[model samples]
Target chain A: MRTARNIGYILGLPVLLVLVWWLSTLGSVNFFVPKPADLVETFGEVWFGDRFFSDVLPSLGRLVVGVAVAILIGVVGGVLIGSVRWLRALLEPTLEFFRAIPPPVLVPVLMLLMGITDSMKVMVIISGCVWPVLLNTIEGVRAVDPVLSDSAHTYGISGWARVRYLVLPSASPQIMAGVRQSLSLGLILMVISEMFASSSGLGFTIVQFQRSFAIPEMWSGIVVLGLLGVAMSFIFQWAERNILRWYHGQKEVENAA
Target chain B: MSPGTLAAGGAAPPKERQRRKAGKGAAKQLLGILGIIGFLATWELIPRLGLIDERFLPPASEVIAALVVDFGLTAFWVAVGETMKAWFLGLLMAVAAAVLLGFIIGSSDFLRKATNSTIEFLRPIPSVALIPLAVLLFGVKIESSLLLIVYASFWQVLIQVLYGVADVDMVANNTAKTYGLGRMARIRYVVFPTALPYLMTGVRLAAAVALVLAITAELVIGSPGLGREIALAQSGGAISGMYALVLATGLIGVLINMLMRQIEKRILGWHSSIRSEVIV
Candidate 1:
């Protein structure tokens, strides 16, 4: 019964929102304010149709590739820098400067060099998303247990095996936290990059529809993207849970203590 | 000044060691400067040497010259001021909404559970995805940028604030109740202090997100700001000017980040996180 009530609350707000949105547009509001039903219909037409293949797929592909590249490079770079005093000191200011710049600012520059290509979009996503992950990984690496390191050293675990088995796992939680932040950033940059270029993507489609006064279609695109964002976030959370199961156990013990 | 200083402070034990480390720190600072110099040199050389086409990306020297000219211009300053205004206003609005809503929702277990899914649903909706709606409603105005900025930053703060509020100890709450403390008194004394550190983290993150959206809105919606100026420069084929404007926005970002960090430190100085700061 309690679960049912909880579930109802979880579902009620969105249902009410959708209903209110539909009702508001029923009585002839502004043309731009699309009805919920109309948005649903349009969403179906654009997304389930062939348009999805060209626009959504490529966008998703870029997001996946960009995020993967960023995580790989960011983690490696972060570990290296975090483990080294001289390197961290030398690169701190430079990293901070680049990280400070909004990722979109780099889009036009990338466009100039790479043109309106998939690589440009991916590069923008990578540049924007890498900083959070890199910075967080550095903190995580530095924060690893000194006792754990000493124990590993005493057991004759010195190099690659030590880092692979212990250090990476110790830092995984912080790295995951950084990855979560970077996920949203990567998504935003994906949209912004596509918007800037008037190229092929969900963002470009939405802006194109809007520019032409295809209001319902534009609203549909927004809805689809929002759903996409929510879904991606859920996947990230689920993955984090699975990968950081041991970390979660440690956290629970800490909390209990 | 950053959280990274924790590692640094632990190593400075003796005066002689500290002095030696200071010398090494100076060398490290020099190395950082040299690294940047090397980067600029590469940027300058790459284009001028015809390794990369000059028309696509002008030399770093030209960009620096353009930045100098931009510093002298009133319009550039106006654009920067416009961006800053949007950033501050949007961030302020986000912080207000997040704190109020966070406390209300977090105060009740039922409300928190009920709103959990709703918040999750709304939180991940990329604010940039709302650009079409913003442009439709405001149409290339400052409000368009504000809409994006507020929407994006609100989630950053709201989630953090909620986490903070939820961190209040149950034991402390029971103790307050046993002492016959009023609801308001309990919240004021117990919840507020516990939530403050999280609030600072939220605000810091929100500040950065807000700046990103402000620039993005201007660039995408053709609003009045440095972002718009960059777009204008790009379209007008003033490559050097465009780079300079982008650099200007980046410099502003660096400043905003530094300012936010300082503010966070000042506001949360009583909190353990800030109190734990060690000077090397």
Candidate 2:
């Protein structure tokens, strides 16, 4: 009975919202707002075919690549800067300045340098997604317990082994947090990059549909984008759970105490 | 949602270290200045040395020169004004709506529970996804920018406010109740103070998101702003001018962030986090 109530609490409002939307739009001739049923039908028709391969997949692929590169660069660079006080001090101000610049503004700059290409879009994503991960990793590395490092040093664990065995594990939790932020940011940049001077991709296709007054198709495209976001977040959570299992268990123990 | 934590994380290194390393602080500042100069020198040299195409990547001096010229132009100021107008209005609307709704929903357990799933579902939908909808609704007007900015920043602030409200001290609340304080009185005295820090953090993150969306809507939708100017400069082959406008946007972003941080510090002066930071 409690489980049923919980489910109701979770799903009730969304169901009610859908019902309201359906009821209100029934037989309505609104140009912008499509009937819920029509949108569902259009969503499947528009996305579950050739467009999926050509536009959706490519967009997802770019996001994956961009985020992957960002994580690699962010983690590597962050670890270096975080471990070195002078280097961190030297780079922090510059990194902060770049982070302040809205990433979308770089779309034009990248477009100018790289032309209308996938690399440009990926670059745009990297430019935006790198900051959070980089900054957070630096903080995480710096925040590593002094005792742990002291013991590691006493054991003669230095160089790459120290970073791999000691620093990386300690910093994994914060790195994951940064990665999560980057994933969403990467998705945003992916869409924005596509929206500018693009011939194909989900963003372009949506804008194309809107410009051509295919209102239902445009709405359907947005639903796909939303679903993509939900799916990416789910995937990240799953990966995070696996990667940071020890961290979570430790956190739980600490909280319980 | 995470940007607040992100900012805090960036600022989190213990201040006591700075005091201890008083001599090192000056060296750090000098190194930071050197770092910027080194970066600028690298930028200036790459094109001049013919390592990269000068047209594609103009010298830093030329871009700065162009930026200076832009500072003198009324049209540039007008674009900046438009972008700021969208950002300010959208941020204000989003913060107001989020605060009001957050309190209403956060105060009631059943309401919070019911809305949780819906909010989660809606929040992940990137505001840029609604560009089509915004354009369809308002065309290329500032409303397009406003719609995107408000939608994007609303979720940022709303989620923070919800968390803030939830964080109200149970002991303080019950004490207020025991003292025969009315709901309004308790909320005004107890809940508002507790939530102010969270709200400030929300507003800070929202400000960044608002600027991003404002620029985006202008860039993509052909609205009147610096973003559109950048696009025009790009298409018109004014490479240095384009870079200059981009630099201006960066400067504005830095200023907005600094302004938000100052506001947060001032408003949250009595909060433990700020107090600890100050004491350190």
Candidate 3:
């Protein structure tokens, strides 16, 4: 009963929002922003049609490939620099410097050099996503309690074993947080890159629809993208909770203590 | 929490700490300088050796020369001035609106709970994706760019403020209330100051996002800015010119970030994260 009440409470806000959306567009208001029902119909058309799968698949493929590559590179590089005090000192500022430069600023030059290809889009996503993961991994490594390290050292665990057994688990939660952030950033850049060029993808579809003044279709694209963002975030949160149950349990223990 | 506790935490031997300190000092300085030198040398030597196309990869010397020579150009300065104007204006509005809204939502538990899902739903929608809508409404103008910047920045800062306020220590709030403080007074004296670190972090994050959106607006709209300059230089076949501008823009971004950090440190000197030595 309590769970049902909580679920109802959770669902209440979106219902209110949808109601508002319906009310606002019932009269002859701004026509550009289509009604919620219209958007739903358009969404149905796209989802049931071939146009949706082709666009979504390529975008999802790019997103998975881009984020995976970024994670591998960022984690490896971050671990190296972070574990070695000397390397961390040397590379930290440079990393921070590039991290600050708006990734989109690099997009035009990338287009010039690479010319609107899959490789260029992948490169953009990698560069954008890598920084947060790398920085967070470094912070996570640094944040490991020295007492734990000392305890491990007492047991003669050093080198790779130390990292795998002690450091990695300790840092996993923070690193996952960074990965979540990177995923969102990668998604943003993926769409932007496509919006800048591509002949397909949801972003391209939106642009194409907007250009043709297919307002309903354009609204549908925007609504779908927004929903995709929310859905992916929910998925990531669920994964995090599942994978980091230990971390959550630890928190509960700390609170009890 | 106490001085005695903190002193006990630092109970490691001085000699070992001294050695670590010296090692850290040397490494930090060496790496920082080495990083700049390595990048400069790569830029200078790589193109000069004809490995990459000179036109596309312009040597460091030529890039530096462009910065110096083109510094006086009306067009370049205009672009910089215009972009900065939009960024600052949009950032100001975002900060103001976000703080106001954040305060309202943060203060009321029921309302905050009611709106929580709505906020979360809107927050994840990449502000950049709204570019089509923005263009449709306002055309390719500064107004559209500024609106997007404000939109993006508001979500970030508002959320930060919300979390910051929510995370305020319960004991601290109760103590203030025990002193007979009213709602506004309690908030002003206790909540805002406690949230300063979070607020600063939000501003810092917003700064980076604002720069991205500002450049993106220029890229998409073909307006005048560093992004426009790069686009123009690329399209005009002035590859070297494009490279030079890109380097300059990168340097400018670095400088802004460093400056913001410096200011954050100065203003929040009492914050442990700013004043205390790093853990590693």
User: Largest lDDT belongs to which candidate?
Assistant: 2
Candidate 2 residue A12 C-alpha distance from true site, Å: 0.6
Q: What TM-score does each prediction get for chain A alone? A: 0.96, 0.97, 0.93
Per-residue lDDT value at A49 in model 1: 86
Order of models, best TM-score first: 2, 1, 3
Top candidate when judged by DockQ against the true structure = 2
lDDT of 1 by residue, A129-187 (tens): 99999988988888989999889999999778987988799999999999998998899
Ranking by lDDT: 2, 1, 3
Clashing residue pairs for model 2: none
- Each model's TM-score? 0.93, 0.94, 0.91
Q: Which has the better TM-score: candidate 2, or candidate 3?
A: 2
lDDT of 2 by residue, B165-226 (tens): 99998999999999999999998999999889999989999999899889999999988898
Task: Flag regions of model 1 displaced more than 4 Å.
Answer: B1-27
**After superposition, which runs of candidate 2 have C-alpha atoms over 4 Å from their true positions?**
B1-21
Q: Each candidate: what lDDT?
A: 0.89, 0.91, 0.81
Query: For candidate 3 chain B, which ten residues in a row score worst on lDDT?
Result: B271-280
Which 10 consecutive positions of candidate 2 chain B have the poorest summed lDDT? B1-10
Distance (Å) between predicted and true CA of A96, model 1? 0.9
Model 1 per-residue lDDT tens digits across residues B1-280: 6655654566555567768978987998998897788778988999888999999988999999999999999999999999999999999999999999999999998889878888999999999989999988999999999999999999999999899999999999999999999999998999999898899999998998899999999998988999999988888999999999988888998998899899888888777776776443
TM-score, model 2 to reference: 0.94
